[model samples]
Target: MSNTKNTAHGQVQETSSKSSSGTRKPIVLMSMGAQERAGHEYQVMTKKYMRPLVEHAGCVPVLAPTCFGSNDLALYLSMVDGVYLTGAGSNIDPSLYGQENLTPEKTQDQDRDRFDLPLIHAALAMGLPLFGICRGMQELNVALGGDMYQKLYAIPGMREHREDYSASVAQQYADVHTVKMVPDTWFASLMQQAEIPVNSLHGQGIKTLGKGLQALAHAEDGLIEAVHLPECEQFTLGVQWHPEWQAAQNPFSIRMFQAFGDACRQTVEKKSRN
Candidate 1:
């Protein structure tokens, strides 16, 4: 069932739609990128990120186009129970955090960077359940006054975290390293373990922890793998890994999605009473 209505401008409007079970599924607002395919610009979001939100999280995913900008950010946030910031093929523009374009030749989604950064703040201000993956996590950090390493591998003592393009797709996404969860953190308790195997696939990594954000897990190389606002009672989290990839098959990914789903459900309940 579709949970959104389309406007002539290509923006989406949320609907009070219910599934066949006579219950409304929690709606998640996913930010989209403005990309050109075959000489035409398109609002695009990867399909992998939507699957776990539907299959495991029991929510209806809705797209928020980057072309529309921040004029309607509040209206969009008000219509959904959660916000999901997904990864992209292009990197965020470095100027957002007072840095020069160190990687000018690399592709950059400036439109998305402009929109999603403000969307992150509006979602947090509204106390919506927020989840970010890969580039999404970096966006969240920058929005909250943090910075990133443009090229993670070039840093002294930092290991190469980019995926092996030469390997098979499954092999490239397969677990390649381990991350140690901080004891007593949500992740450690959720997984019930100290260390968990994870896949690494990114050229950029967090260099400074965002304000009010705490590290939930870290790779053996000391790179922060997961972060959350410790003071935020709502579900506000960002992970450096791509848990949405084959998420249904991974136990850790399943738990993460379920937790996010539960948080979205709680938001629905709270909004219903208001």
Candidate 2:
């Protein structure tokens, strides 16, 4: 553990450990929300799948609320070394990307968009490490001036975006599927194995990429599965698969989080000097 502080910019500041023998644990913020449930219940929750992922990656997971006011948003962003945009149950409004609403199965979570979009901009501005999963990945694209397909099934001849497989078995996990990783990519090094079998569970896919973003990995069906910002020195990787769910049983997925944690630690160390 290391001492954590807040900078003038309202970003969380951390000091790396003096000991050089071990890797420092990164303090990560996982985004969450509160919504009106059936009846009189107001449900506020964070996904159970994200916990082991962070822990295994050698980082501390902090639940960040999506309803933060502008001031609180800065405070929240300032308190973590890195941010993980977890998957949500809703689709992002297309209006954010300067597009007409095309899908009927839209459940817009404006609060999340409000919280995450600004935080993302701040993080990128501050050079903080970021990782997006599924909806998180989609949101990252939108935040970066990209557009999404809304519904993959509606793409005429597109195959299923959501893969069907039992999550319990690692051998069966990459089951009969392959994703091509771009040569000489950071993601290729992090994932170690090229042509990885990834589990997908989203109706949406990136149609137009944001500026300065490069597709790191893609499905055999030509769907974008992973992306990275090559311009940013810090780690800003987004994957369509649920690495959190697979981290426990899959070494391939676990390394992704570990790599992110490593990046956050490095960022904290570099910032400590300035």
Candidate 3:
């Protein structure tokens, strides 16, 4: 709801004049939500975290609202070159995927899901570049016929979702976990490092991978931490960890954003020619 004209990471301001002809415009769509402190005060908070990632990668961060209905969803989806499915506090409704309710802690954000599910489908149908982080990753899997572990701890021996000693959302943490990237995968190439360290902060993980999704990375404990669609021409990735949170400080994180931004650019250019 609050529009701040600034680059990704809150550094640069975008200008039409700065956007040159033949230069592709990468439009990044972020999910919306209600403020944590003020219930019902809905706004797009992902932009605050994603702005740096998008702008640094030379892409325009577009704040897409979850208020769009079925009639307007298609129109909005068509405008973006790529979509960034950011993290959210609510869980996807079990009914959407034909599953029984798993936990009592599940918080439903039907309005947001209704708005994003169609958009995700439209992007995939069009082969637009898409990136999912944390909840975003889970949603992507669900959209593609995968399921999620409603509560990670409920599964015996699972690690904690909310790290007790980690820093706040705005700050970076020194505790890094290792993930093994699949050999010859786009993610392996993008990150350059096969075993990389990443921040941990999510309770949910992919239960059953969706069709066409390749497992690109896994945690030390063998948890599926990253996934991608190989059929897409551009980079379409989803990570269980939040890259935007530490991308500005970590080279690995920055590379992930850069790769996604490059894909977005390509998609924009291809669209413009047609």
Candidate 4:
């Protein structure tokens, strides 16, 4: 599935094969971030987020740039079986959630915020499997009418969740905290565990959950760590952690991505019939 060629318009054209079970690899549309470097702005997505989908999830990753906005969204959604909203260094614009921007030093990706919020609702409307990580999870929440703490550490009773940028990559990604799974929820059932340790690397956290979004897990400080939409008939889950970082080696990360891949394949099968 590694073979790919760019179309005249620069879109990735992947060549994939069907498994022995006669099922083709599921296609997942992942959102990208806008970054300014040197002199020009670029749409970017790190390979860290893409590798988990390919290696563990057994899916083809398609990158969606934020610059396109809503114009071609339906076209992109039409071809993919699942949507993956990945984490980014930028925070969502605080204005979207009725809050003023407090962290001037921390960057905000409004283009991505504009693009992903609508993408979240539309993907769920189509019954596509959707998985969000870190900022992506916060987007899912805000899209569904929830808000976030502009600065989580400033909030009373909440622990500092941001990683040390000065540390080594391995040190920054090391498991630093625990999240207790809500019993009988989709996450608990899939993980088959009461609690799991996770790496934290975000400054903002969910303050109020979106409508129909169930809290799947929580941190020791009572922060929401994972979420799912129970009413949605598809696999819709979001986690406020860097699950994509070394996802292949972690037991919990492996199970999470595999479950998303299965859901995406199920979606493909359903689409073929309809």
The TM-score, computed over Cα atoms with residue i paired to residue i, of candidate 3 is 0.85
lDDT of 3 by residue, 127-242 (tens): 88888888788888888888877778777776765555456645444446888999997678878878998777776788899878889999877789999888866678899887
The candidate maximizing TM-score is: 4
Error of 1 at 265 (Å): 0.2
Greater-TM-score candidate between 3 and 4: 4
Ranking by TM-score: 4, 1, 3, 2
TM-score of candidate 1 to 2 decimals: 0.91
Model 4 lDDT per residue over 128-232, tens place: 999999998999999999999888899899999999999999999999999999998778988889999999999899999989998999999999999999998
Clashing residue pairs, backbone N/CA/C < 3 A, model 1: none
Ten-residue segment with the worst summed lDDT in candidate 2?
A: 167-176
Q: Rank the candidates by lDDT, best first.
A: 4, 1, 2, 3
- Candidate 4 pairs with clashing backbones: none
Question: How close is each model in CA RMSD to the real structure?
Answer: 5.5, 7.3, 5.0, 4.2
lDDT of each: 0.89, 0.77, 0.75, 0.91
TM-score of each: 0.91, 0.83, 0.85, 0.93
- Where model 4 places Cα greater than 4 Å from the true spot, the runs are 1-15
lDDT for residue 128 in candidate 4, whole number 0-100: 94
lDDT of each residue in 213-254, candidate 1, tens digit only: 899999889999999998988998899999999997899999
